[model samples]
Target: MRIVIVDDDPLVRMGLKAILQSEEGWTVVAEAGDGSAAVAEVRRASPDVVLMDVRMPGMDGLEATRLIVDSGSPAKVLVLTTFEVDEYVFEAMRSGAAGFVLKRVPPPELIEAVRVVATGESLLFPASTRAVIERFSEAGGYELPDLTEREQDVLRELARGHSNQEIAGHLYVSVETVKSHVASILTKLGVRDRTQAVIVAYESGFVRPGDAAEL
Candidate 1:
């Protein structure tokens, strides 16, 4: 995979380059020191993925992410952050980042995260789920979508990380019914998957990040 590294810290950029170089099937296409530079490199290099630092001197990662997505750039962004707070996590997701990892993450996990994102799977790291929970908890109460009571129940169960069978059993409904509800939930939320739906749920201010006590 062709990848670009973007960070103000030369040490971090160099370290990432070394690790990426050691991995097979990966190449460091370009490096940038700021968000604007990152965007320009993305347009020029057309790398498959961009490893971007969340905090930058100008055009922070969130704005840069918005610009990249809005520009229809093909490169997927993987934000690197130092914070575990809900604010940063939710902002990154809302800004159209494919995923993010803490800067202190192990080398192996970082490689896997980039690989997963490049392959188009949303990274739902434990920290990510915690951010989502905080988003829901702060909303006073969960935002109710346009669904029946049963459907809402299924969605909540889903946000809690329940499987279809588990949700069915919890609600005393059949597996098929749970599946149908999940489909309906996705439709009403206009999301492509449960992950995006979860993001939307928090972004819409319907669920506060702190509201999650379970899942």
Candidate 2:
């Protein structure tokens, strides 16, 4: 996979580039020290993924991510953050980031996270999602006014990180049914991917963070 690494710290960018390049079939096409540079590199390189730091001197990753996605770049932005509950990380997700990885993550896990994101096979939020929502969400009790009850069920299942197959089985519906529900949820929420949609679920309290295990 072709990738871009973005961080304000040169050392952080170096370390991430080295770790990512160690994997076979992966290439670090470019590196950037901040969000504007990151966006430029992404345009020039057109990488499959961008490992983006949330904090930077200018244009922060959140805005860069918005600009990239809005410009119709196919590159997936996988956030690099030290804290999972960072308000910026939440904002990045809402800006259309594919997912995130903690900076202190083991090399193998970080590599795997990138691979998962690159393949477009999954949304990578884990149990840390709960902490992020609870710590950063501005409000609760928001309703899914546009979704049907069944679409709401599918959205909650999405919060659990279930695949379409899993959600279909759980809801006693076909995978196609789950896919349609997911598409509708995305449309109603006005987001790009399930990760963004699920963030909305959490922020809206439509799927409370604590409800993950039970749902």
Judged by lDDT against the true structure, how good is candidate 1? Answer: 0.74
- lDDT tens digits by residue: candidate 1, 10-113: 99999999987789989999999998998888989989889988788987777777788788887788888887664765676666776677889888988887
RMSD of each: 4.5, 2.3
Q: What is the lDDT of candidate 2?
A: 0.84
Total clashes in model 2, counting residue pairs 3 or more apart in sequence or in different chains: 0
Residue-by-residue lDDT tens digits, candidate 2, 1-215: 99999999989988988999999999999999889999999999999999999889978899999999999999999999998778889888878888889999999999999997886555675677556755676546777667888998888887777778888999999988888888888888887888878778877877664687744
What is the lDDT, from 0 to 100, of the residue 107 in candidate 2? Answer: 94
Once superposed on the true structure, which residue ranges of model 2 sit more than 4 Å away at CA?
A: 140-145
Once superposed on the true structure, which residue ranges of model 1 sit more than 4 Å away at CA?
Answer: 132-195, 203-215
Error of 2 at 45 (Å): 1.2
